[model samples]
Target: MTRNLFLANRIREVLLNGKWIANTNFKEQIINVNWEKAVQKIGNINSIAMLTFHINYYLDGLLKAFVNGKLEINDRFSFDLQPITSAEDWNNLVKDFISNAEKFANAVLALDNSRLDEIFIDEKYDTYLRNIEGVIEHSYYHLGQVVLIKKMFDLQ
Candidate 1:
């Protein structure tokens, strides 16, 4: 009913749906994908795993910052996930994907609506927002791409 209540609900909804996409879209595979077959260079570009890891890598950092409030990480854009060379490893990453997202959702739940406008320095963006809305949106957009890539590889 109040403004704070409304923002809290919005953050909650976005987080829940976003976590769902991460878990639901990820694929389990043994014998890691060859960086070659994993991605298609439609002229010049990286692989699907790279893009997916790009998203997940950001998730790891953003979520940690949002929840823990510690904004320091070395691999800013490194999406290299150490080559998922086994089914178990892939599964673990998927589990981590879900777990970390849920952790973020809980962090959102813990935030006060008043703090939404609290500015935390994002060295990359150089701007801030009231809540984690922008970060969540970023993850969701990439999660969609991850879904598309997974389907493409799985179906192939």
Candidate 2:
């Protein structure tokens, strides 16, 4: 398979579906979680809702960059999740996340293999392939956290 397809598949594996790595994806973990459980704070670690928003924040920004040819996202603002006090709010976030995950994967698949070597946003940020790989790695890192946190909740 092409590099683009491989990258996109990695994105889908972590975010939407494909359990080859983690045995669970973001959709599988967060889709069934209700508002209360999502927002539940365990110690100081991020809530499930916060992690979801954080990942989707990058997905939305990076997906836009893929289309608009510009990268504009701030890590400081990544966790700035608005209050998810209602089931409707939580559901809306999950819905947007799922939509953006698919769109981001499609954007990666559409990328030319040559573009992977091109700088992403700027030289300091490194190549497109690096950023894409970072997304996949970063996602799996947080997905593990989500899984552990959820298990902790189940125990309590």
Best by TM-score: 2
Candidate 2 displacement at residue 76 in angstroms:
0.7
TM-score (C-alpha) between model 2 and the true structure: 0.98
All candidates' TM-scores?
A: 0.62, 0.98
Candidate 1 least-lDDT 10 residues: 24-33
Q: Model 1: which residue pairs collide?
A: 116-130, 117-130
What would the TM-score be for candidate 1 when compared with the true structure?
A: 0.62
Which segments of model 2 are wrong by more than 4 Å?
none
lDDT of 2 by residue, 1-156 (tens): 999999999999999997999999999999999899999999999999999999999999998887787878999999999998899999999999999999989999999999999999889989999999999999999999999999999899
After TM-score superposition, what is the CA distance of residue 33 in candidate 1 from its true location, in Å?
A: 12
Q: Count the backbone clashes (under 3 Å) in each candidate.
A: 2, 0
Go through the candidates in order and give each one's C-alpha lDDT. 0.53, 0.94
Best by lDDT: 2
